[model samples]
Every structure is written in C-alpha cells, then in structure tokens.
Target: MAATKKARQPAELEMIGGKSKRQRIWEVIRAQRDGLTCYALSRRSGVDDCTTKTYMQALERGGFIEQSNETVRIGDEKQYRLIKDNGLEAPRLTKDGQPVTQGRSQEQMWRTMRILGSDFNYQELAGLASTSEVTVSPAAARDYLKHLAHAGYVTVVAKGKGRGAGGVPNRYRFNLGRYTGPRPPMVQRTKSIYDPNVGKVVWQEEVSDDDL
Candidate 1:
C-alpha cells in the first residue's frame, strides 16, 4: 500500500463568539477608507501572519477583495454610494394629494423619485444625476430604487423592462419625498494598467485583452 501523507490539521478560521475570523476581517477591511496593507490588517485584527495571509488569499479567491502590490481593496466598493435613475417614480402624496417629504437621509432618493416622472427609468435618472454633478454608480442607482420600492416611498411598476434587468430595472414611482443630504463629491478614478517589465503604465487608446 502506498503511504499517503496525513493531511495537515485544519486551522480554525472562525472564532467562538459568532462570526468567523474571516468575516470579521472582511468587515474591518471594508471599513477602511483607503488602501490597507496586509501587515496593517494583521495587526488590526490581531491575527498572525499565517492566518491573515490565508484569510486574505481566501478572500481574493472569493472575489471579496482586490490586491495590488502590498495593498488590498474591497470589491463592489461603489455599493456605499447612492444612485439615481429614470425607472423611479415620484414619492406618494398626502391625503391632500401633495408631495410628502420624508427624513433627510432619504433626500437624494426623493430627488431621484421626483426626477423620474411617468415611466422615468434608470438610464434617464443616471444621465440627470451625472449632468447635475452628483455622479452615481449604476449599481448604486439600482440599490436605491429597490430600497425606495421596499420602503413604500415608491412602487415597482414594470418588473423587468430591459435586458439588464435582474434585481433592479423594476420601474418605480415615489410615494413621498425625502432628503439624504448634500451629494458627496464623486470619486473619479483613472486606472492605469502597468507593465513593470516595460517600466510604464500602458496608455494605448485601444488594445485587446490578449495584447496585455
């Protein structure tokens, strides 16, 4: 019989209280406002290099994070922002049939509702928001619409009207207006792919993925 090497003892990935260490680490990493080094994360989480490195590797594989050199960044980072689009309808009115404004935090959402008159869709709302200097990610816009619909601030009319329809693309009409506060400045990122072998960031106007 061939001698099979005994499998290495599995390490504990989750802690006792409730959430696993990986989940906790993910939360902490997600809370970081800017790029974080793996060393910093290890120290902050009080996890040893072996555990931290293993968790990070697992996270990257799960698509929960992105890595560049020594820094790690969260994926779907845009979910933290608010979005606006046309598929939104105005908020519901009062007994008197007047616009009902809700809490301040819902302001941006309310604005979205108002802008999305009859049959107003995400594309139009996104265009309006982009032009208005309050840029929003397409992902954010979809989340906001669904939130409004769930809160009864708006109602979904068309379940799926476009090809991109899935969780969103459900048409909505507002039931009331709300405020979320002054729009935060849009984050403008310009990714410059680098070819360290060539010692420079690639700037070709057009290049196929194979070219890289």
Candidate 2:
C-alpha cells in the first residue's frame, strides 16, 4: 500500500492550482453516479483526502458538485447528476434511462439546466456547458431566465444587475427540478443578390460565395 501511495504522489503533485484536481474529482463522481463518499472519491481520484475535500467543497459552492453529511455526488444533492452538456460527440444513456444527447441547442441547455438540478449563475452555467463566457451572452442568459421565471422551472432569486454594474449578476434557483418542453427549432439562413439593371435575381445557391 505504501508503494502504491508513493507511485500516486507524483500524479497527485501534477494537479497544481487545483484545476486538474477539480476535473479529476468530477470525473470520479461522474463515474459513480450512485454517489461516493469522500474516502471513495479520494481512492478513485488518487488525490489526498484533504485535497479532495477542498476541491469538492469548491465544486459544491460552484454548483458543479454536491455534498451531504458524508456522501458526495455530482451537481445537486437531491438530483445526483451533473447538469452539464459538453464533450457530447454522441449519445449515451444516463442513469435515469434518458439519452445524454437529446439534440438541439435548447434541449442541450435544458438538459444541462436539469442536470445542474438548481438554477445557476451565468459563470456556473457557462462552465458546466463547456461554453465560452460570451457564448451565453447576457442577452441569451436573460432570455432563459425570463422563460424560467414564467414557466416555474426556476425563479430569479436575484435580478441581474443588467451588465451595467460591472456586469450582470443574475442568480437563479431551480423549482421544477426537471425540464420538459418541445425542442427548439433549428433555422438555416441564406442570402440573395439581385441585378437591378437586368431586373433579375440570383438565389446564391449551389455555389460557394468564396468562389465569387
């Protein structure tokens, strides 16, 4: 056991600034969605108990993971599933028998919101979605928050500062405990050009604009 501990130390030392540690601990908790105690998390992540506890607490505070008296789980304590949508190259079955990849951006976001098990701050939402901070721009985030407020899926615990006071700080909380709605539509756009002199129009189809 001592030899094994020694061998894992180098790997543990590799997790500086706690980023890798967060990801590693998250992965371990994800692997066992049924939930794992801190000891179990330490064993699986190959991280020390203290490091695991510290990182786990941070994740919990960020709404990335959850902790009870002893057991640790992904995302919320009651939901026990991470509400995130990134790195989904394909579909897989979740513990609840739902397809991990539900398709469509709104569905993805909805699934993510549910997995998050509660409302989240914009930064938390973006990080869990593996999206850029700007990807969930203030406008888009506001739209979702408004919808959530109306649908009872969530409530605005605090109104957003409106991106004026340094930035928006809209905080939210989940009330529905789940997401259910029709998938959002996907639209494709094309541009057209016209020749005024000839009174003719070009559909701009079947040719790459770069070619012109």
Candidate 3:
C-alpha cells in the first residue's frame, strides 16, 4: 500500500482535470434536448456503450433522467432524456440509485460557509454542516478549512489554543471576494485541492526531496 501511494493509475490521471466518464456522459445528455441513445452517448461521450447504459440506469432511477420511447435499433438502444439540470457538476449516485455519500460532507461544509458568514470555528462549521443524513466531524472540517485558507478562499481570523475547556478553536472567515460559485473545492487523493467553480485545480501539495 505504501509503495502504491506515489504511483498513480491511468484512471486517476484521467480524473486529474475532474472530467470523469460519468460527467462527460451527463454533459452530453444535458446539451441534447431531443435526448440520446445509449450508443450515441458512448460515441459522443467517450464512454463505452455498456457502461453508459449502466450509468443511465442509475440516473434514470435517481430522477435525473428519463427514457424516451425513441429507439435506435442498435443493441438495446433507447433515447434517454435529462430531467434534472443542476448546472455543471454531475450527480453522484450508486447503481441502486442511492446518493453516493462519500462527498456530501464537503458540499455541506461549503454551503454552510456561505450562509455562516465570518468568525466561525471548525467545530461550529462541523455542527452546522451536518444533517440528519450525513455527519461532519471537526477534524474533517478543520482540514477542509486549512485547504481553503491556503487557496485564499478563506482567511484565518484567529488561531486556536491547545485542546481543553480553556482551548479556543481556530476561527475563520469566508473571503467574499474569493467566492467562485456554488460548487465546493475538493481535496484530491494527491493532496491537491480542485475548485470546480472556477474549473481548475486551485492548490496542489508541494513535492519534497523525500518524496523523490
């Protein structure tokens, strides 16, 4: 596992720009008002037809898309229409049409930050960001805030003291001038942060001699 840490797979490399196959397929579908068949999605989206069909199933069940009566007569080709147009970011879902909960915490935190204003601590961020369906921990919230501060989207207003009843958690404020868009900046597996709002990687971890 340690040896594989620095070694990136081809798939991971492809996702560096945040354009995954599912997202590509979703973009195509959203643009096509008349809808597209699974085969057509494969040809245009660069995703294989079978895999597109699988993704289509989940999207359709999730109410993001609906199947049209039109058929292309190639394989099990049937036209699929996009229903929920939630801007650029593709909806994350499982094969069973369930929401992929892995990334929800970031979304919650980002949304809360916008509504929360300034002088908020990581503990407060976590508490407000968490919903009945999802929970956000102080540690995760602190880490995310650190990246945001590094990226200039957030500012460190005050530093926290040591852990205790007397300890005060770090306070932060969202940089109104740095606000990009609705999408949250994501911390990638490579220790970089990508801002989907600006459609670019905003921050990356510096490489050290030890890593080489």
Candidate 4:
C-alpha cells in the first residue's frame, strides 16, 4: 500500500504574556526588518483585513510605527514598520508626569489653540481649528478644550450664561505658562499619493523627536 501523506498543521501563534491577537500582530510586524504590507501582515497574523487595518491605525496614532508614503500597487495596501527596535511602546504619561492625550486629535487642538493667540468661544475656536488640515468636530473640539482646561493646559478665561436663547459660550485661552505637557512630535511630510482603495488623497510623514 502506498504510504499515506501526513496532514499539514498550521503554525502555532506564540503568545507573549497572554497578549491579545492585535498585540501579537504588532509583534510580528516588529520582528520584520523591512516593513510589511497590510495584506501580508494580515496573512501572517491570521487577522481579517478590517481588524488588521484597525489595529494598524491604532498603532500609527499611538506613534508606534512608521508608515510608508506609497502603497503596494497590487493591493493598494500601506506598509508599516516598527519605529523602534527596543519595543518602546507609547507612553501613557509625558516626561513632566502629565497624562498623555489619547490621540492626535487633542494635540491638533492644542496647536490650533496656541495659534489663536486670544480667548475664543468653542464655536469660533472649532471653526478656526478646522482650517488647520485636521478634521475636528465642534463638539469634540469643545470637549477636548475642557479636558485641557481641567489638565491646566488651558484656562477658562470667561464664563457665559446658562444654555438659553442667544446665550454666549464660555471663552477659553491657551495657558502657555502653566503647561508642562510633552511637545508635539515632529512630522516631516513626504510624497503624497491617491489611494484608489480609499478613494482619497493621502500624505505620509516621518515622525521624529521635536527636539531633533
């Protein structure tokens, strides 16, 4: 009788400290010398396209990875590589011991507030901030400004009447003197591309230490 062929087994995914699958995907990308395309990363991690994209976006926002300016021609997938080889994850606190904002949205708001140079209500602030090339809703802008005020990065320069017809909103001013928060990361814009998959123009930037 002919020898029966042995069934092939799938490679077992190694678990590090029982981390979630998303964390494992990050590890796989970190282990690679060259960056991996989203599709390739999904295949290696056994993750679906949507989940992989979500995790990648989270990592990118958290400043853990460097993304490529160009996407793969075949799949139109962006490539990403670990920013640091030493497994330096995003810090929850800044060097001054202040809590780090969860995402780039807050940072953009802070930058816009600094540019405003005077006390302004949330609506005016939001409208001016929106022109800074980052999408921020007026509601989100108001909430984040409140968060910053609570954190001592901003001051409630003036108060308004209760919510009523023709009621003026409280105006706020950026508190440059009291802020000990971390400086924004330096971003260097590179070439741009029009991703057909997303059907939008996208630009990539190299992030580095602001002091550098």
Candidate 5:
C-alpha cells in the first residue's frame, strides 16, 4: 500500500510592524469586531494569560481598548474591545509624551469624581467607587483625592468635622478645567460576531460572558 500524506495546518497569523507582544495582541483585538474575554483572546492569540493581562492593562491605559463592565461565566474574565473610531491611534500618550496609566484605585476615584460631580467628600466617593465594582477604602480614597488635588485635578472646597470629635475631613471638587489628560474612550454596548461560513459578521449581542 502507498503511504498517505498528512494534510498540513495553516500557519498562525504573523505580527505586523515588528510590533511587541502587546502590540500584536492589540492587532488581534483590532481585527475582531466582537470583543473578547482575556481567556478567549489569549487562547486564540497563543499568548499566555499573565502576559495577556499585562498587555491588556497597558493597552487600556493607552485608551487602545476598553474593558466591559460584564464578566465571563467560565472564569469571570472581563471582555475588551477596541475604542470606537475617533481618528486617535492606540497607545495614547499624554501631552508630555508619557504613557497614560492609572491604577485601579485611581481609576475608580477619578470615575466617581466625574460621575458624582465636583461636590463630594472622600467618604461619598469611596462608597460610589465600591458600588461601581472598584473597591476603595476611605483612607485610600482620601489619599487618592489628595494626590489629585496636588496635581490640580481636584480642589478642596470645604472642610467639616469627621464622625469623631476633633477629626476633620476635607471636601474636594473636581477641577475639570485643569484636567487636560486623555479620557477613557466611549465603548459600544453591543458588538457583531464574525461568521466564517458567511464571510462576514452576522450576529450582535450585548457584551456579556454568556455563550454566544
């Protein structure tokens, strides 16, 4: 009997622009119309979970990708999508050409400040941050507020006695005018999934962890 030849599998996608691992990941995300969870993306891109997460954080800080508020059922991983088309490229930079990054606590504080308006105390801000799924302690919130105040992003509006006698807490307001930094990109609520058979994206769904 003649020997049979085995079929060869297709080669994996190559990275473009001699880009770094993170950049390659971003390219993969850019190609997908539907957002992907960290796990799904890692599996498809052949990147490990830890590296994927690190790059994801960097991309998020650069306003290249936005993390959905929802989580996947398999591992509670958050979905990520490229920021909507605004002519701005990924790896967003600050005015001084610095990479824009924010810690989770700082992000929560900033978001709370923006949503709750300029008039709020650290306690209120902390509560709002917690409700928004970013847990922040009151002390930590106060520290973040102080840092913002020093950076001119926030201003002390008032001071009041704390819950305990002789204790004082400062009320701060967001200085929107002074803030000229890059803001988080607006995200779409739903995305379209590509169907290989049809050669086009045919289905749209609310960004969630549920099976498609």
Candidate 6:
C-alpha cells in the first residue's frame, strides 16, 4: 500500500503581533524629520505607492500630517511631515479619516486592570472596564480573563459557579509582575497570546495532528 501524505499547517504571515502597513509608513515618516514623499514612504515601508497615497490622504485630513515645502518637479508626489505625533501606537482610522472603534475595549480593559489592585469577578470587570463609548460585555471580559489566566498573566482566585441555581462568575486577579507593558496581551485568533507592548507572541497553544 502507498503511504499517505501528511497534512501540513499553513503558516501565519505578519498578521500576529506585527505593525500594520500604515503603522510602518508612519514610523518611517516619524524617523525622517526632514520629511519623505509618498513614493519614498512606500518604498521604505515596503507598501505599494497607491496604498501609501490613500493612507496619506487620510492622515492629511486627520491633521496628523501636513505637506512639507520641499522642492519637487511638476506633478511630483507631495512631501509629508509628521505634525501631531501620536507616538508608537498606530492611529486606527478609516479610509475617510474617521476614527475606528475596533480596539477601544482592549485598551480600556488593560488600563482598568492596571488600576484595580484587588481580585474581581468577570461581571465586575466588564462593568468597570466599560464606558459609555465602549461597552465591554461580561462575555468579553470572561473570554479575556480565560486567555490571560492560561498565559499566567492573571491568577484565578476562585472558579465560577456555572449559570445554575446560584451562579457566580469566576474571580481573577491581574498579575502585575507578569505585566509586559501598557498594551494588552492580545488573544489572537491563532490560539496565541500576542503582547503588543513587547511586539511578540508570548504564548501559543501546541497544534495537534487532528487540527492539521
């Protein structure tokens, strides 16, 4: 009988714990105090010229950047200078320069955890971490706690009573000693824990043959 070929897992690209193309472009512009043209930004950041222009347009509208008065030939791409510096974290904006709402909860929860020095239940965490703008549901809090607990970033003070006659949610305490940075340790879809502050995947679950 012929032997069967074994299945292989597809590798993840620069999707996990890596900066976005816009972020890379922003960093390049920030480093170039003199300024850089759209073409130059695209070349240095390894992003396509067209995509760079689109992001630059949004950045210009958001007032994060402005045109630099550098000499250029007729019809040459515009030179840009960083104006409102937002620091290391990339500004998440829509193509139209509108702010995006995707990662707000992650930031809110991480900041709240840093301030709460005592153990708390997931319900309490959700309530406290949430704001009028960004509402963190209990489910979201529970999931975050689960992943962090597995990664040793959070200590489970007590297990929860399931949604039974007298259900009580799990109580957990953040392990400050394990705190990597201000950025939250993200639970990636790849079954991994990515620490943006450290810019690395601190933990990942082992893949099984059955999953291949």
Which candidate's lDDT is highest? 3
Q: What is the C-alpha RMSD of each candidate to the true structure, in Å?
A: 21.4, 19.6, 4.1, 18.4, 20.3, 6.4
Displacement of residue 96 (Cα, Å) in model 4 is 34
Task: Put down candidate 5 lDDT per residue, 93-187, tens digits, no spaces.
Answer: 44333465434566566666776665888888888887544577888787667655644567889976756646778888888775443331111
Sorted by TM-score (best first), the order is 6, 3, 5, 4, 2, 1
Best by TM-score: 6
Runs off by more than 4 Å, candidate 2: 1-103, 131-138, 181-212
Residue-level lDDT tens digits of model 4 in 12-98: 222223333565576678777356777888888776787677766766676666676564577465677777454523234333334
| Candidate 5 accuracy as lDDT | 0.59
The lDDT, on a scale of 0 to 1, for candidate 1 is: 0.45
Model 1 CA RMSD to the hidden true structure, in angstroms: 21.4
- The superposed Cα distance between candidate 5 and the true structure at residue 91, in angstroms, equals 14
User: Over the stretch 1-212, how does candidate 1's per-residue lDDT look in tens digits?
Assistant: 99999653212212323333444455557667246556667778766767666666544444445554343257422111112111222123333333344322234544555655675555545555453534555566665555444434457667764465454556656554432223211111222222222233223234569879
Q: How many Å off is the CA of 57 in candidate 2?
A: 51
Could you give candidate 3's per-residue lDDT for residues 42-143 as a string of tens digits? 899888887788998998889888877654565565776777887877788999877899879999999899887567999899999999999999899989
Model 2 C-alpha lDDT per residue in residues 108-164, reported as the tens digit of each score? 455567666565775676555544422444445555555545535567787776566
For 42-112, candidate 6 gives per-residue lDDT tens digits of: 88998889878999888888888888976778988667788888898767788888888887887888889
Residue 207 miss distance in model 3 (angstroms)? 2.2
- The reply for model 4, stretches above 4 Å from the true place, is 1-104, 181-212
The TM-score of candidate 6 is: 0.80
